[model samples]
Target: MHYLLRRLGFYLLAAWAALTINFFLPRLMPGDPASTLFARFKGKLDPAAIEALRATFGLTDAPLWRQYLTSLGHVLQGDLGVSIAYFPSPVAEVIGTGLGWTLFLAGSAVIVSFAIGTLLGVVAAWWRRGWADSWLPSTLIFVGAFPYFWLAMAALYVLGFTLGWFPLGHAYSDDAVPGWTWAFTADVLRHAALPMTTIVLVTLGGWLLTMRNTMISLLGSDYVNLARAKGLPSAQVALRYAARNALLPSVTGFGMALGFVLGGSLLTEIVFSYPGQGYLLVQAVRAQDYPLMQGIFLVITLAVLGTNWLVDLIYLWLDPRTRDAGS
Candidate 1:
């Protein structure tokens, strides 16, 4: 509880800081939102319309502190204000439409990668000095060092294009609708296949490698040798003793990965033209869509903050040593 409370408090503070920074970043940008919008119109706007636009975006009238408080209040209510690019539509609405795609693809991929990697790590550690330790690290190193975007490009080129096995891009075929129906689900999975594979391939290696190393280190500890000498079954001794200790590090990695998913595979989304938050952020920044950008930034900041709190809880659960140590 102590550990969790400390982490929770830290996350709350960090969230406040992140929100404040998100508020000021756009104001500090090279041009104001109104000017950027005006540039698009290619001419001067009428006085009445110009003032109305400024007021609509919360830019013209209110004191800075009042505006900040109002913005924070709207965030708490999940009202992210109207997107400049998608005028009259709230930023939340724009993100809501695309968030499903990001979560379905990236979230699933992260879960898959964590499962496969952790299992491999356990197996590799248990079989120390055997093929599990030897070949696994080599395999992981080969894959881990490959740049994520480049690996994705390779997957697209070979599997998607040349082999003609998977899709080239998009979440589904144009005819597909968003729903619980078989068609929509299948379409989502089909479109997800390529990006998912790329994410898994790139991420799996590091987890496996880290776990294997931790396992090797754990196996050498005096307690593990004692457990083995007690005539315990090889599997029991390996899993109940060595593997459990080795997995603690993997837990931390999994927490970090959870936080990262909210960022939604930025380069990968751009490369595949996936309409996830990451790609939308790119467009928002380019057009100086302050509302959309702020909304996305808040989502990511909250995600990271929330994930860290969860990690602290997991640590307390898994390692009793942490229970009294931090308190």
Candidate 2:
């Protein structure tokens, strides 16, 4: 209980710091969204319109502390202000539109990569020097060495542009209506295929190498030797004794990956022109949409903090040593 309380307090402090940074960082940028909008329109509108735009975006000439407090209050009330890039749309609403797609793409990729890589790692460790152990890691690491955008572009050119296998970009085909229907679902999956595959392929090696190395070290541990001497099945000794303990580090990595899923794969999204948070972030930056940028940053910060907290709870449940140490 004491340990959990300490962790909770730490996270709360971190959240406050994140909020403060999110509020001020954009303000420090050279230009404000209002000025960008005014320039875009060639200054045809009344000069007062720039002030109106600033007001709509919750910008103010008030003292820094006062403006910070006001922004904090509005955030607590779930009023993130209107987006300059997507004017008339509240920042929260603008974020909401891309949030789902980002979650689906990055979330699915993380889960798939972790599961597959972890399993392969276990198998490779269990059969060290075998074909699976020999070739898999090197091949995956080679593939992962290339940048995400490079692979995305290559895959897009071959599978999408040349062979015409998958849709070139976006979350779904233009013809598909947004609904719960199977056709729309299938189309969305089709569009997601290339990007998701690229992400998984790139990430798989890290998980595999981490787990394989950890499992190899644990395989020689006393408990594992004891399990073998007790006449336990090889599979049980390998999995329940070795792999279970070896999984702790990978779990931490998985939690971090899951936390950042909301941020989306930026370069990959840009390459594919997917309507995810990463693509939205690019749009916000280009338009100098401070409110939207701040809103997205807050969401991502909270997500990371929240996911790590949950991972701590899982640790308490998974390893008795953690519980004992906490106690």
For residue 309, give model 2's deviation from the true position in Å. Answer: 1.1
How does each model score on TM-score?
0.93, 0.96
Residue 114 accuracy (lDDT) in model 1: 88
Candidate 1: regions farther than 4 A off: 325-327
Candidate 1 local Cα displacement, residue 39, angstroms: 2.5
lDDT of 1 by residue, 16-124 (tens): 9999999887777776676667667777677677677777666767788888888788888988887877776889999997677788788889989989987898887
Q: Between which residue pairs do clashes occur in model 2?
A: none
**Candidate 2 wrong stretches, greater than 4 Å:** none
Predicted structure with the largest lDDT when compared to the true one: 2
Query: How many pairs in model 2 have backbone atoms within 3 A of each other, for residues 3 or more apart or on separate chains, i.e. clashes?
Result: 0
- lDDT against the true structure, per candidate, is 0.84, 0.91
**What is the RMSD, in Å, between candidate 1 and the native fold over all Cα?**
1.9
